[model samples]
Target: MGRWEPNARGRLERAALDLYLERGFEQTTVAEIAGRAGLTERTFFRYFADKREVLFWGSAALQEHLVDAVAGAPDCLAPIDVIAGAVEVAGERMQERREGARRRQAVIVANAELRERELIKLANLSAALAGALRERGVDDPAASLAAEAGIAVFKIAFQRWIDDDDRDLTSLIRESFGDLKAVTAGT
Candidate 1:
């Protein structure tokens, strides 16, 4: 089998995940991760500020995709609908790289530290989404609520996608959004 030659940033992320899974997050050293990725510690520093960042390094790009989705959505759509659209768009991006998505999830699942980092990323994503909504003239409580709800839907959908053997992420996101609507409707 051919080994993937990861880009500098991706190499650090993959190395960190591998080390976290094998030896626990607290026990993994930056030097070990750099060695595994066939890079120097200085190269790792150029990509991530610290080891904890490996779990969150891609989040900025993900946030940008989400914001772009919301910004480019048709103006006539409802606020929640716009959020749903953005979530769907983000899901499509993730679906394109199934193996990477699986490995990322697996790494997070295998380590409590990584799981905490994942939660923080989700929270930050929600804040970014809310900020995007506000930029589109959405007001306070509603914007925050919608963004948080959308992120919850995204999380549930993402987990469902990882769990199901047959369903794709886009479909899972759509279904999860519908489910979220149903839950809120009942409240």
Candidate 2:
């Protein structure tokens, strides 16, 4: 059986973020992360492939939540409605992690490689959302459009949420969604 550490992953993530914030992302090394966590480099690797994986642990969970939400949305809802509901559900899960998320975002934004990884992650998520919409019988460009729009709203809402602690992600998501509709309806 594999060795079990109750909070190994969490410790590693915290340590990595702390190091990233102090020394910057590209400057932070895996050994330094492991040392800060009071664990070995081997233990760090046990939890993550490398240092970049440190900031991304919650992303996989968020994607799964979004996928589940879209898949389970009521059939009567439109595509955007389904996406909004999914975003709301995913947003709720992130409320408690806002501070950590903000810090992680700072690290990603400050580094080129991290930013590229983030773009790739978002693209994968958008594609997944589109595929889910297709499974719900949405047509070609419509599904792609709806998914990308939802992601754009999500991105805007996230920025607003991180900037203002009092801001609710779901409300921002809805407002941004409305903003998109209003802007597009004029054309």
Candidate 3:
């Protein structure tokens, strides 16, 4: 019975998404999602602060991994290179869950509220990346620019991953970074 029960977090996310897709985000209630997930409202609260948070379950971990990647990078690498490497490392982490990634992306794309939350999360992540770069002794304008550029690459790579059914996310990210570099060099 315990094994058959859905993972509490995943269940909440799936239930929230189903509700969002069916009734729209503005109309869905946390109690309804908890009930659908076979969890109590309190259990839903334990996992996520609100219904909207269910879609962002992995963001904090992704940010932490990016910070760790930047901190562990070799000292010889340039600031932009360090940020790029961190994004690449994060992409590797994402590669482990292709199906889940696609589903999450679809849920976000289908819901305006989810898309807004995703945008806010991306902005926060870019700030965190900039802070990490600064902690590594990178300077002002360069650190900010590099972090934003890295995030742009991540965005493009993620979209490409959804579009190119045959290609893996990690490879797409690496290619996106290359394309970003080429575009900048050409300008």
In model 1, the runs with Cα more than 4 Å from the true position are 1-6
| TM-score of every candidate | 0.87, 0.94, 0.89
Q: Determine which window of 10 residues in candidate 1 has minimal summed lDDT.
A: 1-10
Best by TM-score: 2
Poorly placed runs, candidate 2 (over 4 Å):
1-4
Candidate 1 has a TM-score of 0.87
- Cα lDDT tens digits, model 3, 1-187, are 2333458888888788788777877789999998999988888887798777777878999999999999999999999899889999999888877766777788789777678889999999999999999999998999999999999999999988877789988888888888999999996
What digit string (tens of lDDT, one per residue) describes model 2 on residues 1-187? 3467679888888889999999998888999998998888888888898788887766788788888899999999999899889988888888888888899999999999999999888888888889999999999898999999989999889999989989888888888999999999995
lDDT of 1 by residue, 1-187 (tens): 2334458777777778788778887898999999998988888887789987786777999999999998888889888999999999899988877766777788778778778878988999999999999999999999999999999999998888887769999998888888887888996
- Tell me the deviation in Å of residue 156 in model 1: 0.3
Deviation in Å, model 3, residue 125 alpha carbon: 1.0
Q: Rate the local accuracy (lDDT) of all candidates.
A: 0.86, 0.88, 0.87
Model 3 residue pairs with clashes: none
Give lDDT: candidate 1, residue 67.
94
Candidate 2 achieves a global lDDT of: 0.88
User: By lDDT, is 1 or 3 better?
Assistant: 3
